[model samples]
Target: MLLISAAPAAAQDTGLNGMSRDQWLPTTVASDAPLPDDATLDTDDCRYDAELPSAFDADALRTSETAAVITVERPGPGGEGMDTCGTVAADGVDLPERLSLGSYVLYDVDSGEVLAAKDPYGLYRPASVIKILLVMIALDDLDMDELVPVTAEMANVDGSKVGVGPDGKYTARQLLQGLVMNSGNDAALALAGALGGTDTTVDRMQELANSLGAVATTVTTVNGLDTPDVQTTAYDLAQIYRAAFQREDVRTLLSTETATFPGYGEYPEFQIASDNGMLYDYPGALGGKTGFTDNARHTFAAAAQRDGRTLGVVMLNSTIAAGRLWSQAESVLDAGFDATSDTSVGTLTGGSTGEDAGPDAASAASAAPTESSLSSSTTPLVIAGLGVVTVLLAGAWRLSRRRS
Candidate 1:
């Protein structure tokens, strides 16, 4: 017979550690991006058709412009190293020795192993990193070739934008590239409106985030310019990137260095450059997203491939000056590479750093069950099952007595 303890009293839903959830959940996709004009709402809708199918079939729930979902038939070259589930890596691993960051996390693309993470799950403002989610989700919902009209709201969106205005139009592809390559807050909002507008799009994002196990995270905006409530952790940001990386289209967008969108009238077609400085500085750098605000400081997430391994890293709420995030991430990349002495990221566990409780506590909670809990259930059950039935019966009797 099994015994059940009274469920622990529900603690208030606290932020990861003691950080306030409010610090994490901002209201607008871009807190600083200017609001769209209300007068042009009906005639000049900025929203894209996210639910359209590949065929533009009205009967389909998604739009035809969305990229067709492709299943990864097999793990990439090295398996996605997800092996860092049970414990953290040792400190001595060859991570760049000098780097200061408030929070950081790294994961192998193929094997899914979290090579290293610092304050991985601590909640912080994502700033523009949130746009990656908006673009990915919109791509899944809408058709890539479908034309989406730009509107005044999206054109004039504040913060960093591709500068493509609302009067012009673009296919889903151009907008997505603009969104990722330029870290366009306007592109994020326009996509949100196209997908279904701010409120509905955000709700859907929350749903997707939960399905992907991005706990301790909340999204209030598509652009992540900052809102009172929009927040996420480095761990959750990695989770979002992991999910996006699984899609070829999303990967293509992130890996791209430059994008061109033709202009209307005297507005010369623009060639916006990528915001990920490391892409220019580091050779193996694939691509990344950048974000910042007084409230958030500097935040960045990037992925790179070298010597047969791909590493994704995220830094959040760093107190350092601007541009330091990339340097810190570069260090993280070095540390991860050093951690794996083996060539093949070595079996998801990524060379298995032998530290006892090494990973950030939150990642450990999400990746696997604790050893103590497992030991308590396993050894006792085995002992009760093997002890000639007398002791097993006694244990059951004891449990019954306690319940009475």
Candidate 2:
């Protein structure tokens, strides 16, 4: 018989000194280190035999069969953190800046390098910005050509609407027009109900966002109507914006300044004009979503391309007196493209617009939000709590008599 010695189970308790055996020494019995406080650890932070999920799995809840997964690291110190956001915006003062308030981000489509960002991870009500995720979920699950009959609930949508009255059936394409061009809340509800044959599309939105590493965000309504749970961080919104913008349909809808969707009776073929001001003034300005609620304030996302370069911009809960988000996005986009004109970091070499460098260049930026600089009304209280932690830590260190 072969001699066998049974291994001990892992320790779960912390010692008197406030360190577990696993904590006092790195748990070498397992190959992986404990997950940081920021992450949701599986297997008790041990390297289990099974594979563990990543901190953020952008590809997990994809709605499309062919959707590819992309992951961008969170912003932090020594990590790809918020400092990156501040530096990029600060670099481009010479350009005609447009953003008035809130967080913003821009990145290279090929290099995955953030060209410019401001307050990327600041949390704010996304308003209709949440529609980006809803639209993606619909695209992922249903075909673009599929028709969804407008329901009474969809028709009764409160905020910005495309005016699809009860039982006025629309093809998925038409609904998408309402969603992208008009930022129609009614279109959002219709899309959500159509996605799963029910009104719970907000849950699907949350699942997709969670998969994309937007840990602090949640969605309670398809239209971003005022609800306690309907909120997202700047980083989360950027990620969703990036995902939606990847589709060809989304791109077309965004760039259009005026659209003539077939209208209802006696409406005389109503014509819709885009609310985004940058589309008219800014070069290569692809339009995006705009939103506002009592809780969310002003929010917007815009994508622009020039000389084979593309950038996405988002702003949330900006100073109300500062003006609209489209103008802000234009300013940020100008700064980003302007920066490319300079030779500071990795600059794009000569490449004509006709030649495609393949899909790699187009998918370059991360969806992660920048570090939050804006303080909430409750932030001061949180700071006071931290001060208490510092005092406690100091006292504990003195009691232990450990002096470095």
Candidate 3:
């Protein structure tokens, strides 16, 4: 059964009577503009053309230009009866009603059982969380000790950077640290250049994700920056994180709270701090990635171990506030840990059919958004639609654990 704590008087005054203090704050983007006309909504590549879901109000989603058409398909038999598309289990663990998130998944690290999730297959901008795929691809293709020279293009990348200049030179290992620890866009560019170029690196990353059963992930940018075509689902992200966690090097880097990178050429030495607060605030935090863009609000993926159980959690399109994101993730992990082994509401397929797989394995994938005519002007509309659906169904699903 669901349990809700009584909100303080102040919370009620703020329209947060049954929510956490953090819930009082709005999402990173909050606007009340009118929904765009149906004629203006792009649907050329949308798989589903029927009436929009009842829970979502077209007017609510149209308020922001970020809205675009989002299609979530039910998983096939191989999906272990889990609704990859946003279906909450009738008897899953109780989740915090106050937690604000667009799409999220909590899974058992060892068993691959989905403990609780909302809009697991709903497509949303990944922000820098996509870097996990890049890290994995880089580790597989390049030697950790290989020195990579930074080029003018690499150093010119926009967004959060590790200050790697055009004259800087560092080993793949160093750049990997900066990529994960600081969400360094420069590190990503350098690594991408080392891997051949952005196109080649992104292609390989996509191939790897498909082979791993992350069918809902599409890589357009090496650093997980917001792109109209780049997208991922919380379900796919959890799969990616679980796969990355298997690598000792990845685990070590993610678990690291702080590290020092020596200077190269004219660049000075620098200390990099992890953006993932769970490493310091939450016990057994295995480290994770953080992502954000104007198009993609706060996004995060992390893992933690307790009582011999390792749990992985992913939250996408959340508030930019770190406290809110970490707190929400911690709550999911707590529920996952408290849940019994049989409490699984679903399972993450990891994009495989339990047989030999290759790049084409995901050609028939159902969860990932298909390439469409969605342009930057209409991206916000899709995001707005997804956000509305998530809000509508967030409270509809029961979180009670099933009793044998």
Best by lDDT: 3
- The candidate with the higher TM-score, 2 or 3, is 3
Poorest 10 consecutive residues by lDDT, candidate 1: 48-57
* Model 2: per-residue Cα lDDT over 1-404, one tens digit each: 00001112364555333544233222122213332221111122222111112211121122346322332234331234343334243344344432335455565544434555554543445667777767666544555556776778777766677778765657666677777667777777777777764356767777767654464566767777655334565656655566556555456656655544555556545545455657656777767877765345467888878888877767765432333457556766667777734322222121211111112223311211111211221122243355555445435533442121
Candidates 1 and 3, the one with greater lDDT: 3
lDDT per residue, candidate 1, 1-404, as tens digits?
A: 00011112342333322322222222222323543222211111211111101111122122346334221122321234322221234444566534435566777766666666554434466777777767656655666566777788777766767766767777676777778767777777777777778888888777666555565567777777655455676666776776555554555566655445758667888555555657556868777787765455567888888888788888775533212467668877877777745432222222212111122323432432222322221222343454545354444544552343
| Clash count for each candidate, listed in order shown | 51, 15, 14
Evaluate all candidate structures by whole-model CA lDDT and list the values in order: 0.55, 0.52, 0.62
Residues 289-353, candidate 3, lDDT per residue (tens digit)?
A: 87765445568889989988888999875653223476679987887777644667777666542
Quality of model 2 by C-alpha lDDT: 0.52
TM-score of 3: 0.69
What TM-scores do the predictions have? 0.62, 0.61, 0.69
Model 3 gets an lDDT of 0.62
Positional deviation of residue 132's Cα in model 1 after best superposition, in angstroms: 1.7
Off by over 4 Å in 3: 1-72, 75-81, 84-92, 264-267, 320-322, 351-404
For candidate 1, what is the TM-score? 0.62
**Sorted on TM-score, highest at the top, how do the candidates line up?**
3, 1, 2
